[model samples]
Target: MARTVEDAAGAPHILIVGGGYVGMYTALRLQKKLKRELRRGEVKVTVVDPNSYMTYQPFLPEAAAGNISPRHVVVPLRRVLPKCTVRKARVTELNHDEGWAIVQPLAGPPERIHYDYLVMAAGAVPRLLPIPGLAENGISLKTVGEAIHLRNHVLEQLEIAESTDDAELRRKALTFVFVGGGFAGVEAIAELEDMTRDATKYMRKVTPQDLRFMLVEATDRILPEVGPEMGRWTAEQFRGRGIDVKMKTLLVSAVDGRIELSDGSSFQAGTLVWNAGVKPSPVVRRGDLPVDGKGRVKGTEYLTIEGLVRAFTAGDNAAIPDLTQDGEFCPPNAQHAVRQAKLLGDNIVRSLRGKALKPYVHGNLGTVAGLGLHKGVANPLGIKLKGWPAWFFHRSYHGAMVPTLNRKIRVVADWTLALFLKRETVSLATVEQPRADFELAALDGAGHRNAERPVSENAA
Candidate 1:
């Protein structure tokens, strides 16, 4: 039976799953390309995801360090993709044979929605190890909420270090451990470590040297994106700033806030940050679709899923063949995700209109990274840069890539103002548990008063 366009009012429905870079950008491009078709009720694009906004992940480290406002990094879906139907629901299962999917809505029951076409862009999730207490105690920097939590947690550690008289407790609170040395871990630790150092000047009791910043990587070097020479330079730079870079070190366990490394070293810390790696979301496995060894949807050069004509996949969850490389699949990164999404959108339209589909083939443009203010590393267009020049390139490249004019302008304004104004050192630690301190103090005071009332009653 052909699926009827019920309440879609006779429009051909295009159901897109996931709202990450691929899903959002594909929907945006579709609306622009198929505007005339859409007006004639020929098509209706519906994007379903758990989030209403798409987060720009590159700036998360800066946001965590208070370099930029958290709100500015996320682009609201409804405001940008006004022509499409945005649904805040997660696709629980995909029945490719039936040309429909089971969507679990945020507020209500799961509903089976039929579609003329389907695009899977469900991105990856953090790849966590079996390290003890990691899931419960360690914090991740994947989302805006996690970044904000890290910012608050770092500042709260400073406060605890300042007020506490117990030497062991203070040392543990002041020490910060970052588990991964990749881009996310390196950028986060560098920015936050810089922020904490600057904040210590205002904290009378706290000193910069007193705080311990450690980076533990299972690999031999950090920042593999920039290659070997610059990676070595980066490690040296961190060492100069009093950061302990422990390479070729494996994390044995992190049970009960105690970090035990394979090198026979043990340390107690209140904060543990994990940024090891990522894996495709489990939603891919739930679908009866062809997947790669890594559980990513296997796709051909045209971005169409293998053995499925009406279905397509892209972004981190799709194992699209890398035509640029001889025998390799595309790497999971925002750079490739955005480009693949554009190509996927065009291919979809071509397929629908009976035109020849184009293959996705784009060579990587190299990599860039920011290590703090006026400090960075980059290798763009075969040009190697370091220190201030690299930092400039990092900002310039990302500033141009940020979606929408509103977001681009806001981010540029932030960079411009950061030059003249002193860095903001205030940490909203209380934001996490707003009522904890107050409630604890009130309870303690009430107990003291109750104890005095018994003596006063006896005397009376």
Candidate 2:
């Protein structure tokens, strides 16, 4: 389905699939380092992804809580990687032997794209479980759409709690449940809980005590990245705020707004947020690439896939060798993903110019987590931090890491305004059903009633 190539004129056409952290950054660095080659028509670069922007995932929780503007957390691919051709499409299949891939663009028919070199950094998707009703009733906080949905949904729930007189119904509407104690689940729940508490101040009927927040983790502790001691301290911090932290518990069911836990507990809630974990995207399997047991592309220390010199992989989708950990692979995190991308880009350039390649190696730097405003925990260089200092470190680290200067400035501005202005509590729930009211009214004869009333008035 590829468009006929009138000419394959260039140094070599390099096609990068996926526009996540690794893909976008690799292309950006390539455009800078290989500018001369690009200008000479020696090489042409193209980056393809279903999304036009690369989301700085670390700031997602803040965006969900309205602490940062959602727009500021995403870096537009084309804007930053101007030297590369950005294709807004999803790669359906890769024929490495044929030197082409099947791409399904946003419009038109599927087409084949030819490439001399391929870089796979398609990233991962949310690891969904078979828990009942999760796919239909539960919401996720991974993407921009999901984050905005959660923000508006939380505020809408508070509004519902304020208007209801039935105690049981009010409790159900106010109660929020989060599954998974990892960074995503814990941070999102903590931030949204903080935002909801602040919003309750404007409600005459709703009280902070009336709202219930629950965190469910199947393991013995939370925040594995911070070690056991800090994890225990984090649990204590949440408990101090009246937030229930359930450890060693499993979510058995959540069908029809009813949640049943493995610990012989049950609750009904209008909203459930799931942030369990992620698995590598299926795109890696499309190519005849070496993969590890986890289905991630197996990459050497130099970021090249074994037996595939022209193909490279990195980020969450690549199982890179952990040189520091003996035989283990690098853990999937932004820390490793960013470093891998830089090394991958350098190796790509070296290969193109017939230069020696360098190995990608970096030791773990520790972890950080933000628990709402002025509350956080971190284990930077094995020195555990808690309270306000940890929160400051978390914000500073992520603010510095967020892609462009424009986004960084906007995020900082949002934080500054938050100090003086109250958080916005309005929810646009009608967004979920823009035309539902009119459709329902038409079916109920309200539209006919209005039409007949106008005719009768005119006749009179």
TM-score of 1: 0.93
**Model 1, which residues run further than 4 Å from truth?**
1-10, 434-460
For each candidate in the order shown, give its overall lDDT on alpha carbons.
0.88, 0.88
Tell me the spans in candidate 2 whose CA falls farther than 4 Å from its real position.
1-7, 435-460
TM-score of 2: 0.94
- Error at 374, model 1, angstroms: 0.9
RMSD to truth, every model: 4.5, 3.0
Write the residue-wise lDDT of candidate 1 on 1-460 in tens digits: 2223354655667888988899999998898889898777788888998899999999999999888888989999999998888989888888888877888877766888888888988899999888888887898898999999899888889998899899999999999999899999999999999999998999988999998999999999999988999999999999999999999998888889999888899989988999988888788887788888888998989999999987889988999889988889998889999999998888878878889989999888989999998899999988899999999999999999989999999988888898888788777877778876554444434354233344435334
- Candidate 2 root-mean-square deviation in Å: 3.0
Q: What is the alpha-carbon lDDT for the whole of candidate 1? A: 0.88
Q: Which has the greatest TM-score? A: 2
TM-score of each: 0.93, 0.94
Give, for candidate 1, the lowest lDDT window spanning 10 residues: 443-452
